[model samples]
Target: MRADSFFGKLTRTLTGDPGPTAPQSGGTRPKDLRRARLNDAVLAGESLVGALLTDAGMARANLSGADLTGADLSRARLPGANLARTTLVGARLVGADLKGAVLADAELTGAKLTGALLTNANLSDAELTDADLTEANLAGANLTSALLGRADLSGADLSDAYLTDGHLPNAKLRGVDLAGVNLTEAALVDADLTGASLTEANLGGADLTRADLSGADLTGAAVFEVRWTAGTRWPDREVEERLRALSQEVEPGVWTVVGDTGRSRGLRLGD
Candidate 1:
């Protein structure tokens, strides 16, 4: 973790501590800084722990509140980077591009970010506990109130993502596509999300308690006041017997999906 090079453009006379200076982690050893260009680098709150910065270009870099714990930043481009509240615990950032990156409240515990692009990234309230983000794209990402416990995010895309009030307990999210995601009240406790797609997803007031939505998908997903107890595992038994025989429970853990269901029922179940 001792690679560094100026190459140029960290500026304020190439980071001799003028434009922004916070990196004082003992007798610094940085050398090599693979592919270092450091475009727009400000290096805010810089510590850059375990820094190597592989392929660093750092486009629009601010590095806000930066610690960059265990940093490698593999394939780094860092498009529009600010990295707000950045710590990046156990960071590697495998294919980092971070398009439109802000990373609001980011800590990114155990971060790897396998195929990170993070399109339109903001990552509101981001923590991403045990993060891996296997096939990450995060289309239109915001992830409001994001914590993402035990995060894996397998094959992630998260189309039209906002993910309101996101928590995502025990998250793996296998085969994640997340079509039309807004997730107005996302919690997703005990999540594995086998074969996840989440078509037309809104899931207003979503809880999904004891969640295991087998063969997951919930087409035309509004699922108003969605709570789901009795160990929820739909997408079987004729779509939970046609959502308990033609979905209607105006109160008490309301899960309504009345119309526009059949197109082979583009389901949006979970785990």
Candidate 2:
């Protein structure tokens, strides 16, 4: 049987459409029935992507491993839905409610997620390269090891998100909030972090070579073991001096004896 014909029949049956034409295999279902049902609903324009309903008000529907490439799912409510390993490439998910959704290993490249609420969503190992996440609320989302290369995250709120070992090369993060977020071992080469807040953020072992940090707040941020250059801004001269002094303060009197020996060290300031 043809794939489109099978899909059309399955969609009609799931949506209760009277024109549903049964196929030879008795409208054989996909491997994941719940995901196939959701995909069918999307194809029939009955439910949006990530929506938590089957036209019967079923809560917490599972759509794991569904292929929803290029689907329009604007303003859908999908809280606590299991979308693990789903393919949402180029899908329109503007303002979708995806709080607490498990999107691990999902492919959402080039998707539109503007103003979407993804709080506490598990996006670990997901591929979001080139996705438009402008103004999306990703607070507390676990994005560990996700690939977000070249993603446009302007004005996005990523506060407290766990991005350990994530690849974010060339990502646009202008005006994004990353306070208390852990970016350990993350790759941010050539990424723009202008005006972003890094307060108390842990960037241990992260490579930020050539990345822009202009006007970014790194106050109390833990940057131990991170590789950065003089191009990385330090807020003000006082803050830079403080950090330099702290580095030297670990060994007291180390710089004091640099100018003279033991006899000169005992001499007074005016003597």
Candidate 3:
């Protein structure tokens, strides 16, 4: 069909407008070709709730502030797309390619993003509470101050990712690779990090209350001023003793380690 016709259909569907529909004689084009057309036609701030945009090629498209709740965008290519503050609750983005996309402050609660490629993506301050990101590639991504409470990131690659002050309470990061990551002042309370790799990671002033680090690697990792409650599980007795030696009880069920620098590099524990 002509570009004009294709855009008209997309516009109607995106806007939820009622219009006359005509069945095409021939079958739709291949997913790649059709997706390219849709990509070219997707406008910013449009409502695409429950839209079926599977395998859409939306690289560099501007979709900021769009409502995409329950949308099926599995395997869609959206690298470099502007999706800031977008509503994507419960969206199916499994295997989607969102590398380098701007998703700051976006709502991704309960979204299925298994195997999605988010390398170098900017998701700072984004809400990913309860999101399923199993095996997602987030290497070199900026997730500073992002809320990942109860999120499942099992086996995900987060090497070189910036997660300073990020919230990951009760997060499941089993066997995930977090080597050399910066977790300064981040909250990882009650997080399950069993067997996860944290080699050379910076955990300065981070809260690890009740977090499980059994069988996890912390070789050469910076643990200065890190907060650990009595419920926190350590990898070994040797490491635990060393950490306790550096820490001091601040209050009931609260322990901290004072840092040898400016800025309150000390850890605190409560609730």
Question: Considering every candidate listed, which one attains the maximal lDDT?
Answer: 3
Structure candidate 3, residue pairs in collision:
none
What tens digits encode model 3's per-residue C-alpha lDDT throughout 23-45?
33563311112244355444567
lDDT of 2 by residue, 59-127 (tens): 255757767777666666777777777888888778878898888998999999999889999999999
Model 3 spans > 4 angstroms off: 1-8, 11-36, 40-42, 259-271
If scored against the real structure, what TM-score would every candidate get? 0.35, 0.73, 0.85
Ranking according to lDDT, highest score first: 3, 1, 2
lDDT (Cα, tens digit) per residue for candidate 1, span 49-168 = 777788879899898997878888988999988989999898899898998889999898989989989998998998988899999899988989999987998998998999898999
Query: Candidate 1: what lDDT?
Result: 0.77
lDDT of 2 at 239: 52
Q: What lDDT is obtained when candidate 2 is compared to the true structure? A: 0.71
Q: In model 3, which range of ten residues has the least summed lDDT?
A: 27-36
- How do all the candidates rank in terms of TM-score, highest first? 3, 2, 1
- Between candidates 1 and 2, the one scoring higher on TM-score is 2
lDDT of each: 0.77, 0.71, 0.84
TM-score for predicted model 3 compared with the true structure: 0.85
- Local error of candidate 2 at residue 130 (angstroms): 0.3
